[model samples]
Target chain A: MEDPRNRQYTNDEITVFWKPAKCVHATTCFRELIEVFNPGRRPWVDMSAASTQRIIEVTDKCPTDAIVWKYNKDLSENELQASTSTSEEVNPETLSTDPETKPAKVTIMKDGPIVVEGEFKVIDSNGNELKSMIMTSFCRCGGSHSMPYCDGRHRKIGFNDKK
Target chain B: MKEKSAQFRVIENKSLEVSGSFEIFNAKGELLKSEGPIYLCRCGLSENKPFCDGKHKNSGFTG
Candidate 1:
């Protein structure tokens, strides 16, 4: 079966593949190019939002090779068709709402919170919402008093990005 | 029996308390411990390392 999470984003010139299984969630892609690789958005990648060269530059920074790209001219007929079909189905807003389409992947942020996506239950010490986040950061710096949810305190206290 | 989700609690500005089914590993990916409500230092000044020894109060850690 084709892996649902193994997705591709294509512009008119090139296509970028996102293998969620290979992602370490170093946050390099989104941190460097939020306009194109926004984690908060469904489908999580917008190939048309940025230039092909810029997307390639950011994709190179992905430590795990989770994001890779190729020119559209290099693709086979089947690949070209698949890329077009995928783009037609691309709706960043509705991608994750269907539980069957995407299983949650927990991304260990570099010296930050555990960013969880897809479907999962999060409970606090008192079992509160702390907040039900689709893509939320959990404190790994051991600094957040809010427990699982990040309060952006890591930046205030100088939490080391390398742990 | 099902495994319980991991738990983490912040002891004010002192330390972070972690416990449950989750595992804590070092940079080398070695398993640290399972039974711990491990108290990890948040003050960024722990000499004992990872664990807290009431240094937050002395260091004036506001986190």
Candidate 2:
């Protein structure tokens, strides 16, 4: 049985499937391509904002298969029917609040930023609350134009984790 | 004791000081550290990789 909450977003060429149950909120989708996967907006996934090739590129980065894509011509009959219906679409905003209050997870990506997720507070050097967010990546390469955040500069400078 | 949420503090031109309840994992999904008040390298000059080793001072990292 198809999940009632599952959503399918389509452009002229491709359709993106969203399975909320499979989303661990690793936040890879929005962080990689917010122009298409912005969680703040209604209907959340805007396939038309980006090219099919670009959308597929970011969708492949999803740690989990919460979001995946298929060509419009390849969609099965049932899937094609679901794609046309907007009445069943659910808001991604309602899924923001994490149900489990587990301690935040800080993962150190090799040759990359420190990815933090779950409930957390960020404070500047002067002890002022910077902002509270569900997920964020801190730059370890020290070359980010956006201070304290990873702007993907490590790759440009060829940062290597020797360990 | 009531467990508090994790807190991350960005030190000026230096490391990121993390405290409170949280878990830290290495690149291979291994649990590296979970205790409070840990200093992580942000200046990218640390010989110790993820941990700060006072290399920022020499590197003159201002961010």
Candidate 3:
């Protein structure tokens, strides 16, 4: 059974599943491709905004499987039935940004980047504040093209934590 | 007065300096020994693993 809060968006080729409960708000979705996943917009996901291939790329970038995609032809019977009815849309903007200050949680992913969540600030080497949302991932691998931020290059470069 | 938020500083061509209130967990989700003002390895050359072992200088890591 699907969570009542879950949402699915479909284009002619694929369907993107969104599970809000699983989101750690790593901000990868909108940060990389806001054209399709804008939190500020109603019906937050617009499958028509971008090509299916482009959409798939961004969906795969989600740190937590908060959003995932599948080919339309591969949909299960239950999924096909569910698609007949419209599901209510919920935006990340609706998710509460707690007012109270608390200790941030930083987790190091094996062979990957450093994931940080909760309240915190990011400063560059020059002491300038970098814009941050609820959460973010930092590059641990020496080869990230986007310095400081993880562009999912750790996997490509074969970073090993134990080494 | 509100407490200062935790700070993550990207030290130029070096480790990431993290300060203020925060808890760091290893890949297994076990809480690691994270005292405030810790410098985490970013160059991926640290023999110490997550913590900086000053190897970035020798490795010529420029990111």
lDDT by candidate, in order shown: 0.59, 0.82, 0.81
List candidate 2 segments past 4 Å from native: A1-22, A27-57, A61-64, A70-97
Model 2: lDDT of residue A110: 81
Superior candidate under DockQ, 2 versus 3: 2
What is the docking quality class of candidate 2?
A: medium
Quick one: RMSD of model 3?
6.9
RMSD after Cα superposition, model 2: 4.7
lDDT tens digits by residue: candidate 1, A48-160:
77789999999999899878888988987866666644433332222445434333444444444444444444544454534344444455455656543454456557777
True contacts kept of each: 0.03, 0.91, 0.90
- Highest DockQ, which number? 2
Model 1 native-contact share: 0.03
Give lDDT tens digits, candidate 3, residues A32-58. 555577664578788997789999999
Ranking by DockQ: 2, 3, 1
TM agreement with the true structure for every prediction? 0.47, 0.72, 0.67
Residue A133 CA error for candidate 3 (Å)?
Answer: 1.7
Ranking by lDDT: 2, 3, 1
**Of models 1 and 2, which has the larger DockQ?**
2
Model 3 earns a TM-score of 0.67
For candidate 2, the per-residue lDDT at B7 reads: 97
